[model samples]
Structures are given as C-alpha cells and as structure tokens.
Target: MVAERKTHPYLSLMNSYLIDSPQPSSISYWYNLGSLLGLCLVIQICSGLFLAMHYCSDITLAFDSVEHIMRDVNYGWLIRYLHATGASFFFVCIYLHIGKAIYYGSYRKPRTLVWVIGVIILIATMATGFLGYCLVYGQMSHWGATVITNLFSAIPWVGNDIVQFIWGGFSVSNPTIHRFFAFHFVLPFILAALVVLHFLALHTHGSSNPLGITGNIDRIAFHPYFSFKDLITVFFLVLIICLFVFFSPNTLGHPNNYIPGNPMVTPASIVPEWYFLPFYAILRSIPNKLGGVVGMFSALLILLFLPLLDRSLYRGLAFKPLSKFFFWLFVFNFILLGNIGHLHVEVPFINLGIYCTIAYFSYFLIIVPTISTLENILFYLGRSNK
Candidate 1:
C-alpha cells in the first residue's frame, strides 16, 4: 500500500520507514530524549549559521564583533544566546539519552552499531563545541585553545610539529582562528549526516523500551502517538532553554571569557565549559603531560567498549540488582569529578580529583565487568538449586 501511493519516492520512503514504523508501547517518557536531541541540534545549527553571518573570525575583531551582535544587530543577541546556550543544552539531552540507553541496556546485541554511531556523534559534538568556543577569542577561549592544542606535544617525537601544525604557524593567531572557525562551521553538517546514519541504524533494530523486552505483542505506530509525545517533550525542553537564554544568558558562561584575548597575561585559572569538566578533570589528574592526555582521551574512548564490558545477560538495570547500585554510583562519581574540575589545582582539590578520576575509570573497567560476571554466575547457581 505504501508503494502504490505513487507519490515522490522520498516522501513515500519517509512514510513507510518513519511515519508507519512500529515502536514499543512500553517506552517511557525517557525515550522522548532522542527527539529532544534532534531538536537541539537543529536549534544549534540554525542559530550558529545566523551568528556566523555577522561574526568576524579575525583575532582583533572576533571579540568585539560578538559585542556588536549583542548590542547593535537586531535580535542578534537572541541568536547568539540561543547558539551558546543550545550547546550546553545539547550536551544535557545527549547525556540523558546516553543514561537512558545505559539503564535499558540499549547498547546490547543488534543495536550496538546505533550506540557506536551515537558515540561518534558525541565526539564530533565535543570537537565542534571546543572549536566554537575558541572562535570567541576571549581570555578563556585563547588560553583554553593554547593549552588544549599544545597537549598534542605530549606525543613523543612529533609533538612539537603537531602543535605547530594545529596553530598554522608558531602560535595561536589569525590562521589558527580562521581554521578553527572553518571547521566549526563545517563539522555540524557532518554531525547532521552522522545523525541521519544514527536514525537509520536505530530503525534497523527499533528502539529499546524501559522494560527491555523485544516482543511485538505491545507496539504502536510512530505517527500520531510517539510523534505527538516527542513534540510535547521538545516544546517543554525549548521553553526551559528559552528561559536560560533570555533571563540568565551568561549563567553557564565564565566571567574570564568576558575579557578579550591577551597573550601578555593569563587568567588565574583556565577552565573549559561545564560539560567538558569531567573529562578535563581526568586530564589534569595525572602528573605526567602525556599520561594526562592519554587518560582524558581514554575516558571518552572507553565508552566504546561498554557493550562488551557489561557481560550481564539481563537487559535492563531493573533486572540486575547489583548493577543498578553501581550505575548510580558511577553517576555520582562523574558529578564529583566535574566539581573537582572547577576547583583550583592546589592541595586537596588535586588529590580529590585524582581519586574521583580513578573511581570514574574503575566503574567501567573493573566494577561493571566483575559484578556482571559474578551476578550471572550466582543467578545460574540459584536456578540450578531451584
């Protein structure tokens, strides 16, 4: 029936694949985050493009141009605020989306590819966010870029060359800003394409429900049912973001960023945005420059192995008693690391950050795999006794 409609092939494909797709009826409001993430991506891209229209990527004009947008350009402040705030909210939605997946065991079996693509999207988003932040050419932006890009120098013999390559000269200057701005503009479209692939992969296996069941007994069409649900969720989320944009536009921003970039002086402390703090904490925890760089990248790259590391047969945390406890512990540990990341690199804070970083890695590398194996073994033994 879908094929016989004789409409445009693209429209017909969307109707057959998306509008008429079957989704698990037991899926909770948590599943709405997937759609919310899509909306956030669109908001970022649209607002970013408009801001780019009047943005000057030159080091001298970059900071002042942003000021011009805020003070002179009609509704430019609205667009700029939306783009900035949307980046933070984008992470908010993706983190919740990931948490939902972890709780429901969405990364298992056939959907593993979907999870992998999602992780890639996350990495690309991080890169894009970092580049966008640097385009502001403020105190934090300048020092942050200098410090982060120089981390490449930790790479043995080619370290200096890598840093020079990234700088496009001897230091972070006009060429560096121009290159970062170009990539920042281009990467979002690549991310959008990856998101399309993510949806294709998701549809290949359908969505995982809160119950973690794959049965067809309770399923519904994606049209009016889930569509309206997703719409409502997006609307609510946009309302919250709008509140932040209008009422407290700078709440998520740092005070240091208000000052224009000056190579002559450095801020007392350099910090990335809140969303990057957990990994940043891991980076700063290690004493060695190379080791710290490796640790930071490992923190993110290790997530790729989560589907393999978690050996439990149970599909959801709800069914796994011990795993559930560890899951929330991991969450708390992550927040602790983020808090530590914001503190000065002195005395107790450094020690605390190191400890939290260890806890963070241990959760995935040691605790999850070990408890999962032990729990499965005990389950089988109990069943045999019964």
Candidate 2:
C-alpha cells in the first residue's frame, strides 16, 4: 500500500493535504469558510468564462451584448445571475473569514505572511469586481467607471496622466471598455495564484483555532470529518444562490444598470456595488480630493499592519474582555460606514460618515494596541498577585 501510494505523486500530495492532514478537533463551522471561498472562486471563474464567450467589449455593443445574453442565449440569464450573485457571496465569505481571523488573532507571528497575502487577495478581488462592473456599460456602470477612474486625478502632478492611462484615452471610451474587460478577465487568475500562496503560508503554520492554542496534540484527519462538513455548507450556499437566481435575481443589483450607458446623462446616485460601500464611504468622508483618495487606500493597506499593531501577549480575543468588546464595536462601525455610503452625501450623513471613518481607523490604530497593552499588564499583575 505504501509503495502504491508513493507511485502516484499527485495522489500522495492529495492524501497529505486532504485525506491524512490533521486539523484541530475543536475547530468549528467558521473554518468551513475557507473551503466555501475556494468554491466561490471556481463558480465565478467558470460562470465568467461562459459569459465572456458571448460578451462584447466594444462600448457600442457592450450593453446590447448583455441584453442578448439575457434574451437570446438559452440559460444565459442564469449564468449572468450566478456570476453576479456569486460575487456577492464571495465577498460575504471573505469578510467573514477576515472577521474570524481578527477575532482569533490569526495574524500573529508565524501566520503574518498568510494574513498579508490575504489582504492582497482582497485588494485584487475588489479591483477585478470593479472592472467586471464596468463591463456591462450601463448607466451605473459607465458613470461608476468614470467616477472611480477620476479619483486617480487626485494624485500630485501626474494625476491626470494616470487617469488618462486608466481610461486608455481621454475618457471612458471603446479603449476603456476593452481594457477593463481584458483586465477583468485576467485578474481572477492572479487571484487564484494569490489564494494558492495564502494556502501555502497557512498550512506552514496550520490553522489558528478559536482558543488560540496549538492543535498538534489534539488533531484529527481532514477526510470524512471536515470534508463532509464543508460539503454541507456548499449545499446550503447553492440553495441560497438558487433562490436568488430563480426568485429575485435583481434584488442585489442596481436598477440603473438595466438602462444602456449614456455619457450624456448621469444617474441620480452614482454608487458602486454593495460590497464596496464601506470603502466608498471612507472616500467620500474626506472633503479634499487628494485626502479622500489617500484615506480610501489607507483603509485597505492598514490591514497589513495588524500583526504589528496587535501587541497582545497572547493570541485571540477569547480571554481578553476589552479587546473582544472593541472588536464587536469595530464590526458595527464598519456596517454603519456601509450604510452611510448608501445614503446621499448630505449634512447629517456627511457628518455620520466622517465619524464612522474616524472610528474605523481608530479601531485599528488606537483601540487595538491600547486595549492589548492594558490587557497584558492586567494579566501579568493578576498572575503576580496570585
């Protein structure tokens, strides 16, 4: 049996990583998210490939091409909705996966590379999603592409050049659509590569559990136990996606997107897809164009500093009262920021967005380190006293 296993290198690798690999017995449903994310990526790539076969990147025909897919091609509508709704679910899983990492201090020490790679993957995913959003060439799609690309103009002296470069000309035109479509097609393959790196970095240290303890002593194989467990969640995901695809496909999408793109007219509200609202709110919160651009990107890049910012003596928030409390508050603030992004930029909403933006940064920069240091002191004092 050993000789036979050794004869097949790929099967041996599969057995090592999946069938015989050991996982913490205490790991719960949260760990199931990583597998779901892999599933989501496969769904997106497959659905997108089929859509690409019929998609036209020319600005004049892009909108019509989308309509043709919906009306003329059999089951094209199903593929379109699956691609659309699958993006949402992908973000949902990623956000949950990130949240779980934060709560469990998965960025500590040995796993810092894993966390860094994950952040890069998030940025890449957002860019790909934005590019795909612009491919439709609808009212919202056109204006959204215009508005977002224009943000690059906030850069110093060369800002306008950057915007023009992104546009592939002076404006979002035929070249822009072609470029965006090309990029939108290519980025998922990059994301897949990054995800593989993320997996390698993770498996080097193994998974971080809720309790933040080493799982070496209490471990179980990855076969029937977690494999079947992951399948259950995949089934549930399929059911949820089916309901959305069949019953209410457009509920998560903007109605403005159904109309053909008109450079002459702008939508009443030029907003991105729901997944981007929090960062979009951060961008809108700042009054200055340059400052807003900086703030928006800083919100994402700051995530890379987590392993350093968290000066906790131990991993996970399970034992730290203050850290856990502030963590939940941070999550609430993020959701609030998303809501603020959805609203029109007015007096009250503007102020609300600004406050949320401050809180969002405060959570990472101030609240985390402060609470962690204080907790470390209290823990040492308590032990010494005992």
Candidate 3:
C-alpha cells in the first residue's frame, strides 16, 4: 500500500516517482520492458560484484580464476551464469524498448532527451559487456579483445596510438586485462546513473501511448495498476533466465572460450557475442579498413537522428500504414545482418552482408522521411474528400 503523504523528503519523492505519478491508461504490455530492463541492471551489478571478489585479472591467472569460481567457490556457478545470461537478456529488453519507442514516436520533441540518453546507455552497456567478456581471459576472450581493440587502428593519424593507449601496451597482455577489469567494474555504476537520468527525462512528459495522442486526458496511477502488470512480464523473464542459467548455461557462449588463453594459437573464426552481430556484420561488409570502422559506428550514431528525420505530422505508426509496413521490413533487414555476421566473410555471405548494410541505412535516410511526408498529405486529402 502507498503511504499517506508526509513531510519527509524521501517519501515525497517516492510519491512523485512511484505512487502518485500518472501513466497512460491505454498503455499495453510493451511498456513493461522498461521495468524488466531495470531489473536486469540490478541483477548484473550484484552478480558482477560478487564475481569480482575472487577474480584475478592477471592474464596468466584470469582463466583459472573463472574456473575457481565455477568449481571451487560456493554457488559461484549460479552467480556467473546469472551474470552472463543477464547480459544477453539486457540487450533483448533494450532492443525491444527502442523498437517500442520508434513504433510510438517516443523519441520526438520533449522526449528526445530520454531517447538520446538511452542510446548513450546502449553504447555504455556495449563497452561494459565487451570489457567483462575480456576479463575471462579464455581463448575467445583474449582473441576477441585483441581483434576489437585493433579496430581502433583503422583511424588515419593517431589510430595506432589510441589502440596502444587502450591496451596499456603494444598488445593485449597483463596490463590490458588489469585495465579491462577496472573499467568493467566501474562502467556499471555510470550506467546506473544514466538509467536514473533516463527516468527523470521520461517522467518530465510522462509516458507515451499506443494511439499517438496526449496522455493527460486519460491517466491512471502507476502503483497498483501498471506496477502489478509489470510483474507479469518479470515472472516470464525470470522463468526464461532460469532456464538458460541452469539448463543451458553455455548455449550463448563460444566453445573456444572454455580453453585458456593462448597467444600462439587463434580461433579459426573470431566473432563478438551474438548481441553484437548486426554491427559486426556492418563492420565486415566494407572492403576498406577505415570505411568499415566508420560504417559500423555510423550505424549506431544514426539512431540519434530519428527525431529530425521523421517528418510526419503525428506520433506513432498506428495510423500510418506505409510507415508501419516499412518498420517491419527494417526489422527483417536487421535480423538478416545478424545472420550474415555469423557466417564466414566469403563469397555469398560478403555480398549478402553488403546488401543488408545498404538496406539498414536506407530505412532511416530515405524511407522514413518520404513515407512520413506522404502519409501527412494522404491524411488531409482523405479528410477534405469526406
């Protein structure tokens, strides 16, 4: 039960954010993804703190430390599995959250700050995940770190210097692992702060609804209404996470990572985690070293321009049939990029990756503005004829 209003500052703030805040009455299950994401952030931070307690960041002992946690420490395996599985699920929830925002035009106008902070959070989370992955110091972890850090060398003048700065040396070594562990440990706290900012920005204008209309006319308290509804999705999320943690712990991981790091031998195929597949595919699609690097970063940075690019008179895609259709097609193209990223960069796969990269950028650059403008004209024309 929500407590009665009081003079205490903490209680008053809680009332503002949780108990008394108004939410759209018509908002559906998609809105629940935000709460799910918050839960995921908490799970990751707690488990990672515990894992770090016994983890040794030295390259020689890093792999062994992970084994010690799994085989020697008490319930360490559960914590480790939870952290790993939670990383994947975090991306799942965030991707859906971004998709919901786009579908409802939540990034437009007053809510642009919220959406921009979210994209920054996405970038931070990617960095944190990459750092954590390297802390394992297994075969895949070591080589993956080497490969990804080397991407910085594609720059024109100071690229090699930047790579060296990141490695703390000429290559991935003892100092590199040590630095990664430190950054991996620190970034989550920054991520948590960013999440708080995201909430503040969102609450400034309240939540968006399905019909693309103002939510003020029909609103409900967040506490007992949608808070309980959020629990429904949380239950399903926990069920799925548990299934992965206990039944199929390594299903999302590479087998090569099980072996200890070896500088002399390289995995025949080195790929980032599955969550990174689409962008990784974009990176590989370009033939030139520098071009691929620019293309990959552009793919992410382009999302920030959505608010300006969408020229429609209204928010949300519910009334825009053409925009809705193209949105789903864009989703398909993204999935295709991820699929291509999993294959070897040769023959048909290279060609396929190139085509998908083009489609991916075209959806934002050309399709969105054109479709939005066309829909605006049709809306007025139909009204006049009626």
Candidate 4:
C-alpha cells in the first residue's frame, strides 16, 4: 500500500493553490503582472508599516515627521521612497493587468465576479492613495484635500454634514489628518482581503488565456513553468522599481508636495497625482460643481458595466477587427485626457477636455456594443453563406 501522506495543513494548502494549480500554457508575459502587482502590494504594505511607526498624524507634526523620516531615521529615506514610488508602480501594474483582462475578454460569463472584484480593488486603491497623499500635509495636499472634500458640499441636503463628517471638523484640520491617516493605514488591510477574494473568484473560473480558449489539454501546473516565468518578470520589475527608488525618486511626485501646508495660501496650480489625472480631467471638464463630481465618479463606475456592455460573441480583440481599432483609440484618448488634465484650464484645454470626455464615454456606451453587434451579424452571415 502507498504510504499515507503526512504533510502539514498549510503545506497542503500551498501545494493545491500554488504548486498544483493549473493555468493556460499559452499565457504570455502579460499574465505575469498579476504576480508583480501582488509583489508591489507586499512592498507597499511592509514599507507603510515601518513608516507608520514613526509617523505623526497631527497637522502640526505630519510634515515635519515626514522630513524627520527622510533626514534622521536610518534607511527611512529608502523606506519612504519605496512606499511613495511603489504607489505609482502599483497602479502601473493594475492598469496593465486590467488591460490584459480586457484584451482577453476575461470579464465574460463565469468570470464576471472576478472582474467586479478587481474593479472594487481598484476603487479601494484609489481611495487609499488619495488619503495617503493627504497625510503629507503639503500645500497641494492641504488644498487638494480641501477641494475634494468641498465637492461633497454639492450634495442636496446632507452635503455639508457629510463634509464635516469626513473632515471631522469644519475644514481640513488636525482631525482631518488623523482620520485620513487612520483610514489610510486600515484601508490596505481591507484591500488585501479584497485581493484574496478576487483570486478566489479568478481561480473558480481558471485564468483566461491570450487566445481566450479554455481547454484542459492546453493547461499546465502553475509551478515550475508559470512560476519561473513570473519570477523572471518580477526580477525585471524590481530592477525598474529600484532604479526609480534610488535614482529618480521624485520624478513621479510633485515639487509642491515638499513644501509644508498653509491653509492661508494656495498653490498657483493645484493638481492631483498622475494616476488620478484622467478622472480629474473629467471632473474639471464640466462647468457645474456637482456635475463635474458626478462625471468624475461615473467615469470610474462605467467600468463595472463592461461585462454587460460588451455584447460580443468573440472573446479576444484579435478576433474583432473593428473593436481592436477602437480599443486603441480609446487608449489614446485616455492619454490625451491625462495630458489635458495637467494643462491649465484655458480655453483650448477645457474644450479638448470636453471632447476627450465624450470620446471616453462613447467608447463604452456606444463604440464597444455597436462593434460587437456588427461582428456578430457578419459572423452569422458568413456561416449562412457557407
């Protein structure tokens, strides 16, 4: 008789999930981004924990404490740089991961929950990032926090109340920083839990491949093959991140964020982090305060409808010529929106922002569905002709 297994429960779990789990052999380097994202999260969390130990959340001390971390604490500069740069890197991986999903039609039936969970993770990440940026207590941080919180005042009845609740006072003050810091510290744990749920849902449907084919014969164990591939990708990503962290640490951050916050004075131009620029452009594109807020949020919420909106029978963009073209157009429009977002709200920039916003929504509300329908019709006609 074969010897009875005597492995620990934890080891058994790891074996089943990591070592024994099967994935599509056709999966390319793009798939490795999932692992890279996880690595980024781990780095952010670890660095954040260390930074939090010495961080002072008070309005008076927050800025000085950050400077203290950089100048006085041993390797605190490195840790701080890692955490700061890691946020940008995290979003980079997530956008690529989401793009890979869209390209492969990973949001289709049976995997809708996985895609929804991923979107939720994205929202959570955005919230956490925004809150963390506020903790810096710089000119931009103070005004940005004030500006964002003030947007809540556009609500009808309880708008002012909600703003007060968020600020924990009349305006962005000591309590504001404290609360934001608390939430910023706690939100990552919540994000970690959501990521676990996302993985569970993804595993239920298995991973979608580049060709959007799902066949057991084409699958292989996640370990040794994909694991090695992921390892190599992670190594390269780490090298890139290290370059940013050590050499060009402040390249992604704003210079205004270095100056201490002064509620009495506002920066000449207040801008958000680069990752937020697309939605920020949408927000500023509108003339009305409430309307701008609504448009900005709608831009993000629109992504949730992707599974239903994309009514195509074909799985990947490779099979849909029209959609492939428009998909790239949508990406180009997004970059344009970001660029316009950074420009002064001048006549030409505002007009450009408006047009880009229209294109952005049209891609989802009109272009995708129409293309999918046309493709389906042509497919049916070709079969009938045959």
Question: What local distance difference test score does each model get?
Answer: 0.91, 0.93, 0.93, 0.91
Residue pairs with colliding backbones in model 2 are none
User: Please, what are the lDDT tens digits per residue for candidate 3 over residues 1-386?
Assistant: 34555456778788888877999999999999999999999999999999999999988899999999999999999999999999999999998999999999999988999999999999999999999988988898899999999999999899999999998998899999999999999999999999999999999999999999999999999988988999999999999999999999999988888999898998888888888999999999999989999999999999999999999999999888899999999999998998898788899999999999999999999999999989999999999999
**Model 4 misplacement above 4 A:** 1-8
Runs in model 1 deviating more than 4 A are: 1-8
Worst 10 residues of 4 by lDDT: 1-10
In terms of lDDT, the poorest run of 10 residues in model 3 is 1-10
Q: Write the per-residue lDDT of candidate 1 for residues 257-304, one digit (tens) a residue.
A: 989999899899999999999999999999999999999999988889
How close is every model to the real structure, measured as TM-score?
0.97, 0.98, 0.98, 0.97
Count of steric clashes across candidates, in order: 0, 0, 0, 0
The reply for model 3, stretches above 4 Å from the true place, is 1-6
lDDT of 2 by residue, 1-386 (tens): 86665468787877777877788888889989999999999999999999999999999999999999999999999999999999999999999999999999988988999999999999999999999999999899999999999999999999999999989899899999999999999999999999999988887878878898787889998888989999999999989989999999998889999999999997788989999999999999999999999999999999999999999989999888889999999999999998888899999999999999999999999999899999989999999999
Decoy 4 TM-score against native: 0.97
Cα lDDT tens digits for candidate 4, 108-166: 88799999999999999999999999999988999999998899999989999999999
- Model 1's C-alpha root-mean-square deviation from the true structure amounts to 1.4
